[model samples]
Target: MSALVPALEVFLVFLRLGLTSFGGPVAHLGYYRAELVVRRGWFTEAGYAELVAVAQFLPGPASSQVGMASGLLRAGWPGLLAAWVGFTLPSAAVMFALALGMARWGEVEGAGWLAGLKVAAVAVVAQAVAGLWGQLVTDRRRAVLALGVAAALLVLPGAGAQVGALLVCALAGWHLLPAPQSTERGLPAVPVSRRVGATLLLVCGAGLVLLPLLAPLSEVWALLNATFRAGALVFGGGHVVLPLLEAGFVPALVSHEHFVAGYGAANAVPGPLFTFATFLGAAQTQMPPLWGAVIATLGVFLPGALLMAGTLPFWAVLAARPGARSALAGLNAGVVGLLLAALYTPVFTGGVRGPRDLAVAVLAYAALTAGRLPAWAVVLACAAVGWAVL
Candidate 1:
């Protein structure tokens, strides 16, 4: 296939996913495996599995990165952009509209509806954690590492705490992640060169540095810098990045209520949680909603996208190493821990105010994980239930 042909194909496939894929980042991975691995035969099951590991190992929105990487596999850079755009468009549009409405109507008089979304987030993250646990936390050492990381974050909740957790996890992963029994793997091809991948990573880092310096001259550059850096450094993907983004924009650019509510609103959407950036951008008072939305969205997403452009080739080399695979497994478990930590405070505390709310969330969770109902349907059901009972 010509580059354009495959890129177009990727766009269409992911656009469909954008519409229907729900249950947050980890759930999106299951959907990707179904569509790309089982349905389209774009990759063998093992190949798709390896690709997901790569996405988990890198930063950005893990699901979005997986889609973009798949696109890159299909059609290089154009495919990367195509995959991201197609998957992101639906939720971004929906979020922007909701955001503008929030700015105008001022946080929806029907706070219950928004609360429905927050409670739904509780279910979504719980489902994601449960799904990841069996896969990532296989051994005792990894299990302890995961739980320890979660506990550490809970004790100290901030950007610094997140970075500290990852660093500690990295050390633990190195020690704990053991060599796999089977060395039965082949290296996959990538569109970028090692040099290109390295350069892209460097650029991401440089922007995180340089743009902050420019922030003094132009305020927008500060927002851009903050968002981009947050996107790049974030591991475990979309939901974990919340505190990073919250620190950047909250209390300064937007109010605490708007920021917290944006988190709730994000769970209600169908696409990437990064679209929370779109909501944040629009919620800001300094610029017009469209302009802020554009800036924040681009800033938050650019880091991970650029890092992929830089890291794919080198990642192929790393994946071949048993130590690296072991380390990635440990890190992934740590990621699950991070998600578990997030589920407690913000997802549980923010939404599950009373027993009635908890019941609604549990039902929503059962519908998603057990019933295997589509997440959109679950959200609708939860919202109506929240209105009536919660």
Candidate 2:
């Protein structure tokens, strides 16, 4: 009963989060930290930091992982399920509705708000890189490793090139980067019923592995499978998942324009950026609007549940391992590099197109960092600037 209380409360709170967590992964993190950590006594600051680290290592949406971790901390399996569903449902529903409207009305034109929205997105990611880097890349050697990784990602173009670069950087950081002077605390231990967790993991793993083989090959299945894969392999955060989804879906007939449009829209909406999957699923093929809605809803969120279920058994074990900790440290550095690259290329270069844009961005940054403005306020103010200027 005591455990259930927190889990139920988390479900309700995250339901609200899913509905109104606009501005993508970085923004979502800000909201979560603000709402859950600072405002609510749900988790300690250190505990939230640990969850962020662990979530970055896993291959799925980072926010979903954070929510799942929050759920696990509160309850057990039921709590995890509740968190995933609560966090995912609101955005999924909205994306599905948007998809239906898109089918009826055609590509949403004159959503001129996206221009400013994307700039805000950039500012948010830049802030994340700055904040996380200071926390994660404490030493000079680690900073050098981060810079080298950023360089490789910028220069290289190919299959797995970015991933390979990240792996190499992680290895370099692990071997060459100085260890923390004070030992880092390991993740909390959650004692689960071994049989139940193992059963859940096996079932989910098997279902995900076999779904494509058994199901009919079509655009729907492809989108579902691709999204599932994206949800599985995307470590770090939501922005990091973009490239993988672009590589997987765009080449296979998913329109780059639609994808970018969906991403832009997702940033405007409040919720997890994983809702981008919902958007993609709905727009995958020119199916009936209802079909699109249903398919997209299922496709986007199925992986969240499966990934959590499958990974549950190993959470305690993996968190306890020294090698895992070292690898996670490296991955954390890689994540910092990835965020840094995002800051430079798409976020910075694309957003700050001219002197006015630069001025707006600098002002926004100053407000966020120095003036201590709320994130949503900064975003809204920037949107106003984009409308007036751009």
Q: Per-prediction TM-score, please?
A: 0.71, 0.73
lDDT of each residue in 1-390, candidate 1, tens digit only: 464897898899888888766557755775675567545768754456556656656778888988888899877788888899999999999889988776544445356766676677677667757766765577888889889989998998754676567657766777767755433332248978898888888888889779878877765887787688789878765778888988888888999988888887777667899999999988888888999888988999888788776777887777667777666566666677777787786668877889888888898889877787655566667677767766
lDDT (Cα, tens digit) per residue for candidate 2, span 1-390: 776786788788788767645556645665566556545657644345556655554566777777876777667767776787787888777776675565433333334454565566566666666766776777776687677767776776322555676677657756765444324533445646557667766765675797667446766666566666676666556766687678656846458877787776665566777777777767666566556556655655556555554565575566456655555566667767765765776567666667767777777778767887656677777777777776
Alpha carbon deviation, residue 337, candidate 1 (Å): 1.9
Q: What lDDT is reached at residue 85 by model 1?
A: 90
**What is the TM-score of candidate 1?**
0.71
Query: What residue runs in model 2 are displaced by over 4 Å at the alpha carbon?
Result: 1-5, 8-59, 103-112, 157-159, 177-183, 191-198, 213-292, 312-315, 322-324
CA lDDT of each prediction against the hidden true structure: 0.76, 0.65
- In model 1, which residue pairs have backbone atoms overlapping below 3 Å? 197-310
Query: Which candidate comes out best when scored by lDDT?
Result: 1
TM-score of 2: 0.73
State the local distance difference test value for candidate 2: 0.65
